[model samples]
Target: NCIIAASDYYLDDDGKKAADLYQKACEFGHPDGCKWAGWLYMTGFGVDSDYVRAIKFYDVACKADDLEACVNIGFMFENGAGVDQSYSAARDIYHLACERGALQGCNNLGYFYQEGRGVEKDIRKAKSLYEKSCNDEAVWGCNNLGGLYYKGLGVERDIQKMLHYNKMACDRDLTIGCDALGAIYLHGRGVPIDYQRALEYFQKSCSNNSMLGCSFLATMYASGQGVTKNLKKGLKLLTRACEHGSNLGCNLLKVHLANEKAQ
Candidate 1:
């Protein structure tokens, strides 16, 4: 019997056992196994990074009609992770996936149109695609649409609309949206600066796994902005962020340490 081991290892905590087991299950013909194995290989969470192998597994999974795998393949092509970077190729794959009703694919396809990547720049098209994804409850799509409204990209700048979509995504627990909104509130962008609100949003974002949020929250604590100065807490938060791969956190920690040494 093929081990239904994918979900178990997909958390992928301690080590290579996760990636290895996923691959083993994949070899035994588990379609989900192929996708998970490909994901681990691409990210190198518990195994050596292997873009070629990642693509191969994704291709197999995609051929099995796994739309998510198809989207991953498109992403790999878009970034040239293992193969030659080809925006056209990425666009084609994304188009195929989007046509098949993959919301992520539609969002990425919107990005391509917005950025003029391998396709003619078409802000209206981008807006349409983003709206399609967002209406379908893709949080990233809502975030992107918010950015367009905020920047007036192919639409008149509309702060209310921007906040509406941003809050929509943040309410859904998307860390990026939370962090962005937190920064906006902290800086008074399109609204009065509200350090208390910033603290709440940053705290929410950080607790939900946003490294940047942790870094900003650490800054707030260290600077005593609407909160008591707590160097110990700040340092601990920064260290946590760094361990989780936030370069901003690492850099800030180094800066603070250097300042203390200078003192």
Candidate 2:
């Protein structure tokens, strides 16, 4: 299909060609073509960024029963992109998508209920939605559910339940879940402290791109908690964590660098 080819071209950085092909496909009434064209316009990838035009194309695709387009429209409304910001509108749209069986919609709607963003604050409803989303294989839902269990929000405090859900999420390659498990082992929260196990979990989390895990692992290295002390390796990990957007890592690196300069 021309749309698929256009996507390949876009991936190869031929934005102009992709945009042209997408336009052609749109003329043929391809729903995905319209959606991708709107995305390009929205992100200024292959065309000038124009929220109005983007919304127009997205509206076309949404009318064609493209659920992703509807999600995009909901995002645009939530963020006030070429439209008045309205959390209520976003919630209604997300609800529609959820009713249509979109897992992401269910997860997002659960967040709204949890935070009282658009709907009335309802921790019980949030818990139920999270359960549904998790059952539907949304990793974030598992992570959220684990947090709620840990905090005893909408459920009784259950460390075993928290650990089970977090482990489930980690087994699925979620970095946040790995980091959480690492913290639990490192701090002896519900189990005896095991520095070796903590290190292993931290390594997995860091390799999976969790800056917090990198920072934790770096601390272990610096303090010789589990492995031999290696300040150089610790600093390197801290640098990487900082580069990946960990403010704590950045501050620690800055202080270390300053101390080195003083030395």
lDDT (CA) per prediction? 0.89, 0.87
- The lDDT leader among the candidates is 1
Error of 2 at 69 (Å): 3.3
Lowest summed lDDT across 10 adjacent residues in model 2 is found at 132-141
RMSD of each: 2.2, 3.0
What TM-score should be assigned to candidate 1?
A: 0.91
Residue 207 lDDT (model 1): 97
Indicate the TM-score of model 2.
0.82
Clashing pairs in 1: none
Deviating ranges (above 4 Å) for candidate 2: 10-27, 36-57, 135-137, 259-263
